[model samples]
Target: MTSGLLKKNLVCRIILICTFLYLIPPQTIAAELHLALADSTCAPMKEAGLAFTRETGIDLQYSCKSSGLLARGIQAGIIQADFFLSANANWMNSVVDNGLIDRQQVRPLLSNDLIIVTRADSAIKIQKLADLTLPEVTSIIIGEPSRAPFGRYAKQALQKSGLWDELKPKIISKKKISLAVADLAKAEEGTAAILYRTGLADFMRLQFTIPASASEPIEYYAAPLKTMANHKEKAMFLAFIAGDHFNKIFSAVGFSVIHSINRAPEKSVKASH
Candidate 1:
């Protein structure tokens, strides 16, 4: 009876061990890849990251910031993302110049447009970009040209329309396009703003979207970092973005997927004298 009872106890222990082994994962899952993208593409990118993980079991960790700041961070060695997507060419070039990214891997992926917007209850009226120059408009919010791609585009639009000098005094510069949009809602009466059209859906009083010809197209480029430890995973992520599936995600969020990135060599869009 004692030997039989001991045999039964050993069998129970073997069964428990088998169950625990079955519950354990077959292989350790990989850590998430870091992706740095422009703030404007945050929503769609997040969604895309989820879908990519579902499809490939490789997760993504996102860090969204203004393209300029991201470029500076890359230069300063403060940011270590496997991938970096910028809102404009200049910032991407800055990364390349700093020897942080390989130019061969860089490719344009999406484009966005600048738009003039105002509060729904704003008393100040605007028919065109020139309208901001009127004395009645107290303040105009814009991304600061030095560090914001949208602001640089907005400045170019104003300069293209011969409105920059006249409107510069009234311009209230914000560090990021998101901030400018948010502040526009709470701005005092008689104030207006310019920001990315992608983020203008919920906002009222969208005066007009600046034509691409008016301001240089806001091009988005993506590339993997040469220093990234997860080179294979980064390549997979870039490949995922290159496919039509990812383009659908971008289109849903107001970004136009562009097959061809041809444009005149980037020259500084100078403010009118």
Candidate 2:
């Protein structure tokens, strides 16, 4: 009789364990939603992400890639991002072409400009964008124009100055602005580079800046992915992005806030995907 009671208690405990396991959801644990962003703006994203989590308690998982790579990832269905932050409208359009993002959810967020930079100790002095062609400047680094927005802007500025042909051979294409900056640091003597204003904050020895009027206005855009599993969480983050708090974050990172939360200005120069 004692043995029978022992077996019955064991069966009851097994049934209780199975019931507990069945009642709990596999995905109920804390998890971070995915965000795909431009590699150059990672610093500000991290700052904003921390603040966002503090207020919303939802962790953000960032995948910082070049705008081209991010777009391709979105297109190929390799990256299942909740939010996509691109440095240029062209790359964003590429993703949109793939129907990965909802059109109504897209909006321009901020703007930045290209600037000239040399190593801190370099003797090259550039007083203007045209000065990049000086004899002393042998190697010039710009991001790859095909994938990097900053690269395309730099190319446009150089083309406008009629120096694209003369400087094309000297331009070394780096995938990331930060990589280009690092290349500048380790470059042979007489090396220089063209980078975005956002990249200038972390580096020294700014030679000259391309006037905003001279270069095409570099506008960054953001959108929520249609495949997002957590729309409520993404909407919260998108609201934060359009709020004044994100404006400060962008300003701190040297970006000019567009202020319009729903659309980019009609006058802004549009880039082709």
Candidate 3:
């Protein structure tokens, strides 16, 4: 009789354990979601990701780099990301063309302005684009056009303004815009760079704004990969970013939230399986 009672108690404990496991949410057991984003979006997304983790109990991992590099990595299957946020439409279109992400699901997230900046204490005074050609200016740092959208925009603006040829001698191309900004910060007095107006370090001061007519519009697009397994959790994250709370976070960092007529509904974006 004692042996039978002991066996019965063991069976009941096993049943209770299975029931508990079944009741737990899938996200609680699944791996953390991974995101690939352009370096420029890191500032706001970092804060947003934390808030998402706190609310959903789903942690996030990030791989931030130049949009071109990130897109290439995705195409080559070298970077495994559940979602991607690109700095421009060109890179996003490339991923779409490769069938990595559904084009219909891509949505514009933010917009930024291009501007020229120099260290605050720099002796060189640049009031306009033409000022870059002055003898006092030694090197003008810019993102490498092939890898960074900001660099391509800077090149296009210079070409349109007819300053490309004249300024070519002093141009220093960095692989990423953030790197170019860093180079400017540490360089000698005459160094300057073309960068997104948002997130400039305190020591950096705007020299002049690049007019919209000078280059293609700067816009950011985001989409989840077609291969992602965590659809429900991914949808929750997407909706979180589209909400007013995330918008305020982005705005605080100087990003202009996009509200296009064709934008996906703010409540959710259904991922294509």
Q: Using alpha carbons, what is the TM-score of model 2?
A: 0.88
TM-score, one value per model = 0.82, 0.88, 0.87
User: lDDT of candidate 3?
Assistant: 0.86
Better of 1 and 3 by TM-score: 3
Give the best candidate by lDDT: 3
RMSD of 1: 6.2
Per-residue CA lDDT of model 1 for 1-273, tens digit only, reads: 999999999999999999998898744546578888888888899988888998878878888889899889878878878888888888888888788887766777788888888888877778877788778888889988988888888889999999899887898998887788788878887888888878785755888777889977678877778888775676677678877788898888788987633332233311110
Whole-model lDDT, candidate 2?
0.82
For candidate 2, the clash count comes to 0
User: Once model 1 is optimally superposed onto the true structure by TM-score, how far is the C-alpha of residue 235 displaced, in angstroms?
Assistant: 2.9
| Rank ordering of all candidates by lDDT, starting from the highest | 3, 2, 1
Residue by residue across 1-273, what tens digits does model 3's lDDT show? 999999999999999999999999875695588999998998788899888888888889999899999999999999999999988888988898899998778888888988999999988888889999999999999888999988989999999989999999999998887788778878998898999887477998888998988987788889899999887887788888878888898898888998642575333232211
Model 1 off-target regions past 4 Å? 1-27, 260-273
Stretches of model 3 off by over 4 angstroms after superposition? 1-23, 260-273
User: Which digits, one per residue and each the tens of the lDDT, describe model 2 over residues 150-266?
Assistant: 898888888888999998888899887878877877787798888888887444688888887766668888888888888678768878887888889889878998877656434
